[model samples]
Structures are given as C-alpha cells and as structure tokens.
Target: MLYIGIDLGTSAVKLLLMDETGRIHNVVSREYPLFFPHPGWSEQNPEDWFEQTLAGLEELVSGADRDKVAGISFGGQMHGLVILDENDAVIRPAILWNDGRTVKETDYLNQEIGRDRLSEYTANIAFAGFTAPKLLWVRDNEPENFARIRRIMLPKDYLCYRLSGTFATDLSDASGMLLLDVKNRRWSKEMLEICGVTEDQLPQLFESYEKVGTLKPELAKRLGLPEAVVIAAGAGDNAAAAVGTGTVGDGRCNISLGTSGTIFISSRQFRVDSNNALHSFDHADGTYHLMGCMLSAASCNKWWMDDILATKDYAGEQADITKLGENHVFFLPYLMGERSPWNDPMARATFTGITMDTTRADLTQAVLEGVCFATRDMYEIARSLGVHVDRTKICGGGAKSPLWRRMIANILNIKVDVPACEEGPGMGGAMLAMVADGVYATVEDAANAIVKVRETEEPDPELVAKYEERYRQFRTLYPALKPVFQEIAK
Candidate 1:
C-alpha cells in the first residue's frame, strides 16, 4: 500500500508519494502566484491552489502504482482565510498568514477587547496574521463579501474540501486561527461571537491523523485511484514539520528556519505562558505544543545576499565568515516586522555598531547571529515556562548550512540534531497518512519507526559564553527601537 502527502505551501503545492515502509517513491511540485494588492496585504486565489494541486497529483502518480494508494494527508500553510459562498465557490482571494492588513482588527482584539480575555478564550493572543482578525477586516472593509460567506476555511482545508468533498480541518491547523479553544480542543464560543461568525460557518474539526472522508469519485477517477482512498485531516506546517523530525512526546523540540523561523516544543500537557509570548496550540500527535514564530528567518539572509549583495552564492559569501560570535556588528532580523514575544508589525530590520573598519564578513556574520539570538529569545521563553529543552532537531533551508546550525547550537546552548530526511512538512504529511491507513498504530509510533537523525552539532562552551554576552546586547536593541519603529510606520 502507498500514501500521499500534500504540502500546500505559500508559493507551491508539493506532493509526495511513499510506500507503507516509509520509502519515498516520487515527489512533484507546482508553483502558483501570490498577489499583493496593498503594501502590507497578501492574497492568493483558492482556485489556483486546487488546480495546481490537481495537476501536481496527476504528475505525482503518473508512473506510479496508483491502485495501491491507501490514504492522502496534508501539511499546509496555516491561518489563511478562505471563505466560500452558498454555492461553495471561493468568495474572494485568501488573506494569507503573512498578510499584515489586519492591524486595526488585531488592535481591536488585543487592546480593545484585551489580550487577557482573548488568551483566556483561545489560549493565544491575537496577531495580525490570525484568521479571526482577517475575518474582522473583511467584515469591516468588505461587508458585502462577508454577508455572502457560508463557510470559513483555512488554506489546506479548502483543498481538503475539493478533494474529499468534506468541510473539515485538523486541530493543529485550526489552533492558529485564534478561533480554537486550544486548551479544550474546540471552537471558542466567545471568539465566534467576537468575529460575528457562528459554529455553522466553521468546518468540522478532527485530530490531525484522523480520517475525514474518502476521496471524491470524480477526483479519484481523474487521478486514477480508488474511490476508497482515505483523506486524513493533516496539520499546520510547523506541527507537521515537528512530526517529520520525530519531535513528539514530552520535552521534544524542533526548530524550523524557513521563510519564517519557528521553535516548536511538544508536551503531553497543555500550557500557556503568562505573557502569551509563544503560541499554545494543539499538536498533530493528539497532544499539545508551544511555538514561537519569527516572521523572517532565512528570508532575511535571502534579502541580504540576493537582493542587496546581488549574489546567489550563499556558500561563497559564508565561506569567509570564519569568526564565530565575536563580531562587533549586530543585526535585528525584522525584515517583515516580527511575531512571537514582540508581535510588532512596525518593527524594521537594522544593523547597529557598524564601524568604517567593519568588513563584509562582519555584517554577514551579524545577520546569521541575529537570527540565532532571536531563536534563543524564544528558547528562553520556553525555559521560563519550565519546558526544559536540552536539544532540538533542526530543519529548513538554513539548517542545511553547517555554520547556522553551529550558531544555533552554541547560542541556545543545546545540541542541534540534523535529520537524515529534511523534506519537512511534506514527509510528515505522508506519515500522518500512514497512521490514518493503520500502517502505524499511532503518530508517535510512525515517527519513532521512520524519523532518523543524521548528525548532531554539540554546543561549545567557549562559543556559547561569547554569544551569551552578544545576545544580552541584541535583546536590548529591539525594545530601545520600539518607539522609533512606531514613529517610522506612522
């Protein structure tokens, strides 16, 4: 038997085919356009997502044994708002997770309604990117469209509906919507009232590994598969990536350094920080996890290297950065504002302490160190909550860099384990499918059986000490510049 994993990403839909034994047989990707109608707004057509995914699925199983496919699951971009009309047609372009157009709505929730109440209701504070705020924005700015909404879906849930003909979402993905009572694993009634939505407007909820429904007959026929193909309710990208790294069970940790950086910690018990610096969400493994998300991670490096430096030679540029934690320059990794801890959309990236004698290598090293220090900020928050993390599995593009991995290990003073398979969320999605197919009894069982670590980067005490002093300084820059960022935005 085989399983399929669909990773519905921001730029593309990635499909993976794997057998019951966890061996990947084929992978396919299809790119789609991301639209920006305003400076801070991001949108994508839901139709484009379904079409590309359909096309990609056809290509994914073109030369494979389609009849043996047992189940399909997903790991997708979370918190994007996708509304449908009575006819089940997309009402408008989806407002994406990175979209920052909900400032007014976010303020209304966090300040006017109060963060304490919001956190109590949802176990998370409002961010501009959450689906609830986006709904409020739509209600206030596009009342006509809001009036026509019959269903509210997340990005991947829209695909799930198209494929399985079921309107459903998994706990991990729904948790980020600021609509789930994560502590209770149900929709928050207060949030529904606050957003002017009802229970009927939301999709049915399921655990990440639970089967939602079988594939639609038409879709099954088009893809040359059986109509009995199970559709598993998958998880948010971060949680799925955690599963892919085998970061399940209590005290497990995974760090992803993709376009956005996230520090994900899994726990058997549900816990929310007093300040709500980290998001308390349901895990894909039927447990719970805390996540701290940074808006820009490797994208900051891409901006500095590709946009500013005009070089695609990331390795070539880093080759000269031999000096580890002794740089005089400091960088704030706030290229796209920031989240987790600060939640400031006005924050801007900056390089401080650059002297005329500062070399290019010094600035480049600062960029990498800045991201590591920012990660440590989240790690510190986790420690403050008594979630002791001695080590973390590392994934994403930046994790591929030995220098960045070393920096993370030393700065956070933990062992950074590199996984043998770095496919991230897509691989995790397939694992969930295996669980749904009964090939594995539990998510943890599948993870334990399949996930493997290739190597570990142990922290150096000397380097850790140097970074400790540097991080002290790095932490001060953001707070000091808060007013400045606010003024510039105004």
Candidate 2:
C-alpha cells in the first residue's frame, strides 16, 4: 500500500508519497506567500494552504496506482491560530507561530496569570508564539473577530477539517496550543477557563496515527482518490520530525536545523525541567518528550550566504572553513530573537572577539559553531534533569553540510547519525499514515522497520576539548549582554 505525508510548512506545502516498505515514490512541493502586515506580525491565508496542498496532492499521486494509495496525513507548522466563524469560513489570515504581536498577551499570561500556575495547568509557560496568547491578542485587540470565533485550531488541523470534514487534532499538535494538559494528553479545564472558552470550542483530539475520518467523498473524487481514503490525525512538525528520525524510544534524540531549530529528546516518562528551559510535551508515539527550540537556525546561515554575501552556493562559502574550533570570533545566533533557554525576544545577533587576524572562514565557522553552542545550551539543561544523550539523529538543510554536521558532533561531543532518508516531518507523516492503515503495528515498529542510518559523525576528542572551552565562553556572553539588550530595546 502507499501512504501520503504532507508537511504544511511556513513557506511551502511539501507532499511525499511512500510505499508500505518506506521507499519514497515521489515528492512534490508548492510554495505559498507568507505575509507580514506589520513589522513583527506574520500571517497567511488558510485558504492558500488548502489550495496549495490539494494541488500538490494531485501532482503527488498522479503516476501512482490509484488502488495502492491508502491514507493521507500531515505534519504542520505548530501554534498558528486558525479561527472559523459560525459558517465555517476562515475569519482571518492565520496568525503564525513566529508572529510576535502577542508579546503583551504573553506577558499577561506569564506574569498576571502566573507562570507557576500556568505551568501546573498546561506543563508550559507563555511565549509570544503560543496559540493561547494569540487568542488573548485577538480578544483584546479585535473584539469583533474574537466574538465571531466559533472554532479554533492549529494550522494543519484546519486542512484536516477541509479534507475529511472533521474538526480534529492530534495530541502532539494540540500540545503546542498552551491549552493542553500535556502530561495527561487532554485539554486543561484551567486553561479553557483562562482562554474564556469551553471544550466545545476545541477540536476533537486523536493520537497522531489514528484515523480521524475518511476523505470527504466530493473532495476525494476531485483529487482522483478513493472516497474511502483515510485521513490520519498527524503530529506537530517537531514531533513528526522526531518520529521520522527514529527518535521514538527512550533516550533517543534528534536535532532539526531548519527555519527553527529544535533538540528533541524522547522518553517513556514525563518530566519537566525545573527552570522551564525545555518544553515538556507528549510525543506522537504515546510517550513524552522534552523539546528546546530556537527561533533561528539554518535561517542564520541563509541570511549570511544569501542576503549578506549575495551568493546562492552555500557549499562554496563553507569550502574554505577548514578551521573548526580555533576561531577567535564568536557569533550569537539570535537573528530572530531567541526561545528555549534564554526566552528573550530583545536579544540581538552579535559578532564578538573579532580581531585583525579574523578571516572570512573564521566568521563563517562562527555562524555554524554559534548554532551548535546554542543547541548545547539546551542539551545542558536536559542533562540537569538527568537526560543523558550519547548520540543524536540529525536532520534539516543544515545537516546536508558535512562541515556543519561535524561541527555539531564535535561541539556537542556526541555521535550524529545521518538517516538514509532525510525528508524529516514529511516522511514521518507518511509513516503515521501507514500506521493508521495497519501497515505497521505501532509507530515504534514502523520506525524500526523503516528508519535507517547510513553514516555517523563522531566527535574528535581534540576538537571536542577546544569546542568545550569555546562553549564555556559562549554561554557567558548571553547573560552578560542580557542587561545591555534590555537597555537598548528600552
């Protein structure tokens, strides 16, 4: 049987077709415009996502045997607020996960509502990107729209609704809404009260691999698909990416260096970091995981290579970066501000300790090293909670760079495994669909059968030692500059 996985990303909808044995048949991508109406606001038309995704799906399944295609699922950008009115029409362009207009609402939730109480209720505190804050922002600023909201959902759930005609979301995707009791995998009553909504306002929840409903007959017929094709409740992007990398069982870890970077550590037991440095959420595999995310990751490299250097050949720029840990210059990868350990929106990127001896190679090396160090900062906090990670599966565009892969391996001093298929969340979504169709017994069984590492990057002791010293200094700069960043923003 064949299954389809759709990655509903910030900039594009990526669709993949995979056989039951996990071999990819074809992949299709459709780009959509991302809107920035205000300086710090991000929005996108929900209709655009559905249109592009459907277009991509028609292209994805065109050449395949129609009878072989069994199921479809999604892995999507998390925490985007998608509201529908009584008529089930999209009320507005979705307020995206990266949008920062909710800073005031975030402050109210984290301060006036109290972080400890919020944490107790939902296993997380407020961030400007979380959906609950977006709801509060709507309630406070656009009262008419808020009053018109008859349904609320995450980005991909909106697509699932359109495809299957079911208002549904998976636990992993719902966990990011700041309204779920993540530990219990249910909606929190306290959070519902805080958001001024009831259970009726939320979508029905399902496990990531469970079949939500069959595709709507008319919609399926239009796409040349069987009306009986099942739609599985897919996961949040990070969780799906983790599953794609086989980071499902205990102690498994994966680092994604996409537009946003996340260090995901999967476990059987649920545990929250005392400092709240990492997000504790339910995994798609019916377990728990801790994730630390940074708003900017590979985007920093893209900025330097594309906008700053005016070059498209990323490999050509990195070809000369021979020196790894010895560079005197250090860069703070906070171009999009920061999340996870720091949680500071005012933090700005900085190039420190550059001397006359600094070369273009040195600066380039710093950018890669800076991201690795930032990832390690979260790794350190997970260690504090007794989460020991000896190795990690690596994915994303950054993982394509051999030098960056080695840098992450050495800087974190752990083995970095490159999977045979590096499609990330898109592949994972397909796997979830396969599970929903009974191609596999469970997510873990599907992972064990499909996921494979072709090679591994091992850290050099000498390089690790040098990078350890550099990381020590890198950790200090953020704290020392915290006060300066606040003053400048003021």
lDDT of 1 at 21: 70
| Per-residue lDDT of model 2, residues 149-228, tens digit only | 99999999999999999999999889889999999899999999998878998999999999999999898788888888
How many residue pairs collide in each prediction? 0, 0
lDDT of 1 by residue, 278-364 (tens): 999999999999999998899889999999899999999999998798899999999878888799888889999999999988989
After superposition, candidate 1 runs with Cα above 4 Å error: none
The models' CA-based lDDT, in order, is 0.94, 0.92
Model 1 global lDDT (CA atoms, 0 to 1) = 0.94
Cα TM-score of candidate 1: 0.99
- The reply for model 2, stretches above 4 Å from the true place, is none
Q: Please provide TM-scores, in order, for all candidate models, with all chains considered together.
A: 0.99, 0.99
lDDT of 2 at 66: 76
